[model samples]
Target: MIFYFSGTGNSAWVARQLAEGQNEELLSIAVEIDKNKEYKLREGEKVGFVFPVYAWGPPEIVLRFIRRLKMIKPEYLFFVCTCGDDTGRTAQLFSSAVARKGWRCAAGYSVTMPNTYVSLPGFDVDDEDVETQKVHNAVARVRFINEEIVSRVQTKHYNCHEGALPFTKSYFLRPFFNTFLMSPKPFHATEACIACKKCEKACPVNNIKVTDRPVWGDNCTQCLACYHICPVHAVEYGKVTAKKGQYKGRLLRDL
Candidate 1:
């Protein structure tokens, strides 16, 4: 089974392409988290995970779901992570995380997709031209990865884009980002909100509730689904995202 967790459609698009190319079953990790069902991979079936890189590392939701899932180590296990620029030792961290669960990631790949992180200073969504080019490149990258996985290529690191200072970014800065920045407290709808419940419905983890306005819960994974899915330019992360562009968050409809 190919499991995926996406916030703004980048990883979702990659996962869909891979599943179709490899003829693998696609499953949503977020949806499966609440289930009591048990899963065991057949002898020949391979396992794959597709998710976005968050704070230069794998998202907390992915690691959490990995711990929750029950499965026999497949003949080939792999992961694909989407990122705006580069992943800093994310592959290393992801491989170690899965190793702790008695599963080995036979290979890992990173694809540069459309940028969606705009909550911080000097960081915003990519322009139309850059975004389009990244999407175009990602399609080709995923195609190559699909063929590699289908061939059961067991390279520990396959086509990973790990930029400079991998250890510092993954180990040092990632912890700080997860601790201080990954929170829902700064999220609130401005006066432009129309009381539309789209944010509540778009949240992969059900961390949003809409009454007169949307209220965020503490269970959030900081995926920014609500901020991106708002039809109006109402959702803001404090004052930072007020002037930032919005991502379409296309795959939220499937959640």
Candidate 2:
């Protein structure tokens, strides 16, 4: 089975492609977290995780889910992470985290998708041409990842888009981002909000409740789903996203 978490549908698209390629079942990590159940793997069954990268690492929700997940010992295990730019040591960090749960990550891969992180300076959605090219390239890359997983390839480092100064980005900058910047306090809907309830339904963690406007809780994944999926572009993160572009990915019909 493949456990996945996505915001803006980038990781969801990747997860779906991988699931089809491997002929495996798909489980949303957000939904599974509340199930509070245990699972047993058949002999030689492979486990997989698919999610998006956040702050140069795995999403906070993904890490927390790993801690709460209850599963028997896994045989071959792997992961696929989606990113807008590059994943700086994200897979390594995630592997270390999952190792505590008695699961060894045998392989890890990354796919670059359209940028969705707009709650920061100099960050915005990719250009239309760039976005199109990324989706096309990801199709071919996911096929390669599927072939590697099918062969049970084992590796140490993440076979992903490791950009320059990975250690500095992942180790130094990531903690700072996680410690002080990741929060839901900055999110609010402007007057343009039509109370469509799109933000409430788009929230992966169910942290939003719609009254006249959407109310955010403490358990946000910072996935920006509410921001990007807003029909009238009503969701704003402080003031950083007002002029920024938003991207909500569409899935390919076939991998």
TM-score winner among the candidates?
2
RMSD of 1: 2.3
Model 1 agreement with the true structure over 139-191: per-residue lDDT tens digits:
67887998888899989446689888888999999999999998889999999
TM-score of 1: 0.95
- Which runs in model 1 stand beyond 4 Å of their true positions? 249-255
| Regions of model 2 farther than 4 Å from truth | 251-255
How much is the lDDT of residue 117 in candidate 2? 92
The candidate maximizing lDDT is: 2
Models 1 onward score TM values of 0.95, 0.96
Clashing pairs in 1: none
